[model samples]
Target: MENGKLDTRALIQTGVFTALYVVVLAVFGQLGALIPILQVMGPFYIPMVCGIPFMLFAARVRAFGQITIMGILAGALVFLTGQSWVVLALAVVLAPAADLIARAGRYRRFPLTLAAYVVFSEMLIGMVVPLFFMRGDFIARISQRHDDAWVNALVNLTPTWMFWVMIAMIAAGAAIGALLGRTLVAKHFRPAGLVT
Candidate 1:
């Protein structure tokens, strides 16, 4: 508690969770590439799968800036893998949102924690939205490296109306995930003294 620093145990837990989050992201990314329908429904998978680690991280760290660090690390890793910087930027933007939710709950409120997990999931999974917002620019960027047919395939897959539909799906996944996290927390983390 001195100087607002994390104790060693908390630091270790946060690091482990952050690494887990990145690994899961990478796995889902590869899976998305392999499966067309899977790629179209990333929101459903990312939030549901990744939200577990996020809730664990939030519970253990229970401090300011932990989510931000996790987001930055994930972003940096994604960038190193040759992905766009925009995803990183979105993650960073939403980190504070998670932080705020955690703070308001004092990091212990199950309901607020669930909400935080939902928002956190949105941060990482929402990166696909640039296609809907900046349609021409996104297509042009993809066209630079990918062939026109590839670009066309991508565009056709992501219809204009599907953007909001995807968001709703993500939110639904988040709710499902947060509920699962709550159950896990009550059954496992609390009993094991992982969360107070």
Candidate 2:
């Protein structure tokens, strides 16, 4: 295929992936907003495991720039749909980071490199961004208002927790995504003669 045609195809694929991400996140966000217990774990949507498929698709098409586009689209969708704007900004910032990690992995050494990616990704989204955007007063108020169980849980699952809960959630999501990516790649992508 010509370069322009290839780029068009990649763009379409990325758009589809980003739309799927936004839909999934919106569903989870609704769930989290409605249910108190679900809100505690926050439905694990922030780390954006949806991006894993996009990253793999980028690797297949050798269209790394699509990652940036996917990030922007997904972030915009989230903001438009009422997710925190801070998270939208953070997604834009973190998308390139994810692309770099995916590039380094080359879709090989899935366990180690992908685990590192998930860890850093979760830290950036779940820990650092929140620490920057969320007010100390807000956190303190939440801590004060809630029982020690809730406060301790949040603290234990976050920065001091090395953001493990977020990591675990992303890892779980990514594992599923990777499995799906493998099958999809083998079927639609690999046969297209794209750059795996």
Candidate 3:
């Protein structure tokens, strides 16, 4: 990018990849909403599915801020989907850290990019923030969308202690997702010369 600022091409790429990431997140997120079991397991699978687009985006990143932009859009997407603002807040914090991690590698080192994505993926923890920090409000907000019985069932299914478990799951999923994305990039993108 010229003058260390993202130009039109980078912004356009950010938009396209962010849109892909949002679509992927929304589709999987809805599955969790429809199925409590899936919701419980969301920390594991959602990040994994999102890896493809994220890795593709990472491949195209020529300057800083692209990952952060995607993270902000992702946060906004979650907010638009009726989640608390915590997601957005976490994005503000975590996305920049991720951006720095990638910048350390000049966005060309695969391992650093993978680590950045894992960190970026942790922003999803905001989804669970309310469960621990704002339980009453979380329940109140969720109750509006789901029946009390379903809400109760979900609450019962996810104990407060499980928050830590969810964090671990998110981390594991992010690692796997990054590896899977790396593999795909190697197998397909590299051969196709889509990324170097």
Candidate 4:
């Protein structure tokens, strides 16, 4: 970043990654629509699938703001798609924290990058926040947007204790995703010299 701002290339890269991340999120999110159980299990697998693009983005990050920008844009997109404001709020908090952590590792150290990803992935917990904190509002809102069957299924699948379980799943999924991402980066990007 020159003069404390992202230049043209970084902006373009951010746009590309942000778009990809949102697309991935949308695609996986649709699976939840088709199979309501996946919605309850989303915290575990969504991060695993999204890790490829994010780690690839992290590999390319040479500055501070890119990941944060991507996260905000992606979070906004998710919010636009009918999720809670908590998602955006968490994105604002987690993205910068992730960026800072990755920066501390110079964006290459495996363990730090993994930790950053784990933290970043937690932004998704916002999706489930309403379930715990605002069940009445969430059910009312969700029922308006979806069929009764889907909403009922989601509500049935998500017990109060499942919140903590989802958190643990996000952590495990993020770590597994980080390993997968690191492996792909090593096997594919490094060999092709796409990222160093």
Candidate with best TM-score = 3
lDDT of 4 at 54: 87
Tens-place lDDT per residue, model 4, 1-196, is 1223577888898899889888988898789877887887788889998888888888888578898998898889999998888999999999999989988887878899899999999999998899888999889987998999888888888889999999999999888888888889888987998786
After superposing candidate 2 on the true structure, give the runs of residues whose Cα lies further than 4 Å from its correct spot. 1-6, 43-60, 112-196
Q: lDDT order of candidates, best first?
A: 3, 4, 1, 2
Clashes of each: 0, 0, 0, 0
- Worst 10-residue lDDT window, candidate 2: 119-128
In order, candidate lDDTs are 0.74, 0.55, 0.88, 0.87
Clashing pairs in 1: none
The whole-model C-alpha lDDT of candidate 4 against the native structure comes to: 0.87
Ten contiguous residues minimizing lDDT sum, candidate 1: 1-10
Tell me the tens digit of each residue's lDDT in model 1 across 48-120.
Answer: 8777777777777645777767777777787788676776777787777877887787777778877777776
Q: Global CA lDDT of candidate 3, please?
A: 0.88
Q: Residue 22's C-alpha lDDT in candidate 2? A: 65
For model 4, where is the 10-residue window of minimal lDDT?
1-10
